[model samples]
Target: MRASDPAIRSALDHVILIKAHLLQLRESLTALEDVRHSPRGVVLIRRCMLDVRMVFEELMLLSVSAHGEAGDRVEQSLRKKHRADLKIRGLNELNPNFFPDAIDLVASDEPGVAGRFTSVCEPYLTVEQAKRIYFRSDQLLHASRIFMSTEDFEAHRGELIEFYGLTERLLRTFEIDISGTGFMVLGHLNLDDDAMPQVFEAQTS
Candidate 1:
């Protein structure tokens, strides 16, 4: 029998709906380019682009912000619900720090970390900037803390990755003339060389 939770179905529906809009926008833009010679066509195309951008920016924000919206009972139920969050099961109970150390290489059945990592990044990126986002491991874990339930974490994980991928694709589609998009990546850095290799950096570069 198929698992049929209304909440799960709703979440899936939302993601699918969001992706469908993106597909429509892509199609519309492709269609728009063909009609570029007409002033009315250009205006309409510009409007569509604006609308798509606005809609997706809101979506990306929603995807990230919704992570911990499930409430404290859900968040603090780790011991009682061992399999509730896949991260908890995968996490080393004997050695609690195991998950933090392996976060960089860990891949769940769903895109848990990947999605969280992706959503936190800005859409427009230069070559160097893109590298920073790819390496933003620490921030991803910090953000994933809210996904207490394995079901919830796995369920919405792909959306985060999609959000990040959307940014890259949007930049490509528009040739993103980002002369001054005023976007920057912020991360922590370790300052103490004598602190030990085990310590994380203490600065954002």
Candidate 2:
């Protein structure tokens, strides 16, 4: 069987569902982008952040299901009876730190290996950014904290943009054929640069 074989039906389903969810999320982000000039933009920004957090959660689920030893557990958790259990498992399994493990898996002594892997895997958002977004999204979603200054709003808005970019990249990079859009290079296939996200260095003072 080829690496592109459909033998892993559950993973395929998960990818499709995640893509669909991402389409919903893109709509939300586009709405936020349009109304960003208004004062009400803050609220929309918050909603986008929440959606980003959700997308991140689903990405983690896909990561574990696709790459972890507990892949079978991930499959079980997808069923109706196991959803609650899956929530707990997701918390532990989807930790963004899993990126390092993924890096390790792709580690090689080849000169360009590190650069290529970092470009593809860690791409835009850092692990720290992921955690911060998840945390802040939680605070905003539950109304556990309420302080929205202009600076804070700008910061969150920037983060939301970055989050949006990262999510889009992940979907495109690891996407499967069932979704009708994806960038995974089949055996002997070349990666299409236009299909990949444009890389930009984050400015830091």
Residue 136 displacement in candidate 1 (angstroms): 28
Clashing pairs in 1: 84-150, 85-150, 115-161, 187-204, 188-203, 189-201, 189-202, 189-203, 190-201, 190-202
C-alpha lDDT (0 to 100) for residue 52 of candidate 2: 69
Per-candidate TM equals: 0.29, 0.53
Compared with the true structure, the alpha-carbon lDDT of candidate 1 equals 0.31
In the range 1-205, model 2's lDDT, one tens digit per residue, is 5543442443444545555555565676677666754557767766676566666555455444434445555445544432333444454553333331111124568876562233354665555666667667656665535457777767777777777676555444332222112212211101223232221111111
For candidate 1, lDDT tens digit of each residue in 1-205? 3332332333333334444444555555555545643544434444444334333322222222222332122234323443323423322232222111101122445745342222223344333332233233223323343423435333223333443354434322121110012111112111122221121111111
| lDDT scores in order | 0.31, 0.49
Clashes of each: 10, 0
Task: Please give the RMSD of candidate 2 to the true structure.
Answer: 9.7
Best by lDDT: 2
Alpha-carbon runs more than 4 Å astray in model 1? 1-5, 50-54, 57-205
